[model samples]
Target: MTEPRTPKWRALADAVRRQIEDGTYPQGDALPQLKPAAEAAGVSYETMRAAYKALESEGLVRSVKRTGFLVLEAPGRRRVTRDTTVTRDPARGYIFPAAARPDEPWQVHGRPFRALVPAPAEVARHFGIEPGTETLRRRRVTSPAGEPPFQLVDTWISPAAVEDAPQVAEASTGPGGYLDRLEEAGHGPIGWEETIRARMPDREETQLLAISTAMPIVETTIVGTSAQTSRPIEVTIRVIPADRVELVSKLQRARTARWPVAPVKPT
Candidate 1:
């Protein structure tokens, strides 16, 4: 009697791994044709394709139509960063107002607006604060000027500064944006610092962000403080897909006031 056959897809993936180890398909070598591999492995074309998918998930090979599978030279993670104007447009000569509150959880066009919960432990540590602290968390999904949402952003702010303002407290009932509240409270943030890092997403984050399991994430942690006082007040963490979204920060120099001195009397 003939021995039972192994699953075709798993067998194919094993063959590719062997090729890598033996240098038959050295780093950066093109993968063997799937059709031919199917024949060689005594597997159907569909099963062979499934094998390729497995390799891709392991970050072993990349496939592009007409390009076949190419072994990535370096097998490591990646991150992307872009400098965008704070305002809608740089030429407009206007600063982008700070995000103050959560938008109504209604659909704009077909896509629903987003919101965020308070900071988790790692996020809270970035801001030098305790977790579960009373902070304003905002979330939003933004699309290109005329496209579907390609990016998601979540930010956190302390209530210490804005609690006195009715509009700030009312965010729970309506749309609450941060910059607006800051302006109303007489202590608008004039400066900020942003720290970003690349990392893999956990299962829960992957579901919430709605990203592919194969993709990585870039996390941006921001600390916004009062420009006048130069004191830290709020810290925020935003997770973005590595493929989408760019972070831009433009800082202006603070001007020193020139106090007028009484003219000295000449003897």
Candidate 2:
């Protein structure tokens, strides 16, 4: 008898590629997230994740920490490399104002996008809603110009947020793109919290990210909250290829009163 089919992950990855090529998933459309796809494909979640990693290595799928996988380029789109800078200023704060409606094309030197439907568990856990609740999810890969993808980002928002901010519901063709609608609706948060972890990539991750066997992945979980209420509104997960990516943060107090009181001296 023929040897058992090469593990399910490879098969699943190939199937997704096939779907994308045949226009089943379509450009700008969300593909199924991992759990459901694994169940349908009759494989374990680990196996499913493996498949996605393979696609990622081939530059077909991108993994975001919190959001699921996303398809950045069309099935047959060509990727041309140019010397570019993937670094952002940590000390300088940049905001894409709501009114400008700036556009960033998907083919920028760094940053690739992956989109997928939310699974029931993810919807409930991430958005504080019941299973089956609807949401829009995207994962982004940001790398330094002429470097490997250094950052993986996953983002999720309630369907209501999308419905209210119709522009955000639309697929971004590039970067600094969706924030406009969120800011316009006054939903953008002033601060975010991040959690970090370190781990080695599995077989699929190793292949898809084209990472060396020795490299570890630095995983981060980020939650954005309203400046006023301090309530969490957005959650992001990012996985950085440890060899090529670095995470940077800068904190600035908004006012004097907001600063902590100093110890008193004896009168």
Candidate 3:
């Protein structure tokens, strides 16, 4: 018996996928119309449409009515190095290079969403406060220009921290942003602990991130402690679209190393 031939639509889809992967038709580029593509590929118009539909299902392209199919900027795998060193200035509390880069390609916009709600059990534990304590929550959606937001960060700070400095609760917190205000209020962060996990996004997250349900999300929890007092002052939860960004950490081996220790016998 002879082997079956590949479907025209599948072959067309594979060719388009290769072009996208090789940057021949870069992200945000519009693809040829179904009729034109069909003529060029020597296939029926319906076959070309099927190929485009396959690409859409794979998250490579999206079709807009009246408009042609547009390529999507599918996030490629990247290793984002985590900086362990804490760089601070008297004028500008803590400087995080990864959080905000001055020379980024895309423009960043931070929109604040404020709420005063009781702290959850995990949040309270991180904040070193009892559950149900009324906390000032500040949520910000950071996005690249003309694109879906990259991350949603919810910060919970003690009411006392923002008591003297009301600007901390406001939407616009000046040039230095929230951390600067916190430092001026005498609750600058001296140390922080971060825990990262991967999970599926909820409905609200899917809408805000503008991502499909199949996409996974990266959740990072950061707890910041006061410099003056060792008490926890801020707890921030960041939700990152896994397809858009990657988290990387670099660890150094200790200089004093011992090798080839004898195996321990039964105790």
> How do the residues 79-115 of candidate 3 rate in per-residue lDDT, one tens digit apiece?
5678766676555556553544544554444456787
Query: What is candidate 1's lDDT per residue for 99-192, written digit by digit as tens?
Result: 2112313222234333335657865665466886656665666543433334456655555554545454443433335555564576664466
lDDT of 3: 0.76
Better lDDT candidate (1, 2): 1
lDDT of 2 by residue, 1-267 (tens): 878767667777888899878888764455688899889888898998888787766655565546677664422212322221222223323331111112432223334444446535743565567776556677665543444444455677656556556665556523455544555567655465556689877665554554444457876666656553455555666665654434343555766657477667999
Clash pairs, model 1 backbone = 99-178, 100-176, 100-177, 100-178, 101-176, 101-177, 101-178
Instruction: Name model 3 segments beyond 4 Å from true.
Output: 1-73, 76-78, 88-93, 97-102, 105-110, 128-134, 144-147, 256-267
Off by over 4 Å in 1: 1-81, 84-118, 126-128, 145-148, 169-176, 245-267
In model 1, what is the error at residue 57, expressed in angstroms? 4.1
| Error in Å for residue 82 of model 3 | 1.8
**Could you tell me which 10 consecutive residues in candidate 1 have the lowest summed lDDT?**
100-109
The candidate scoring highest on lDDT is 3
TM-score of model 1 (CA atoms): 0.50
TM-scores of the candidates in the order shown:
0.50, 0.45, 0.63
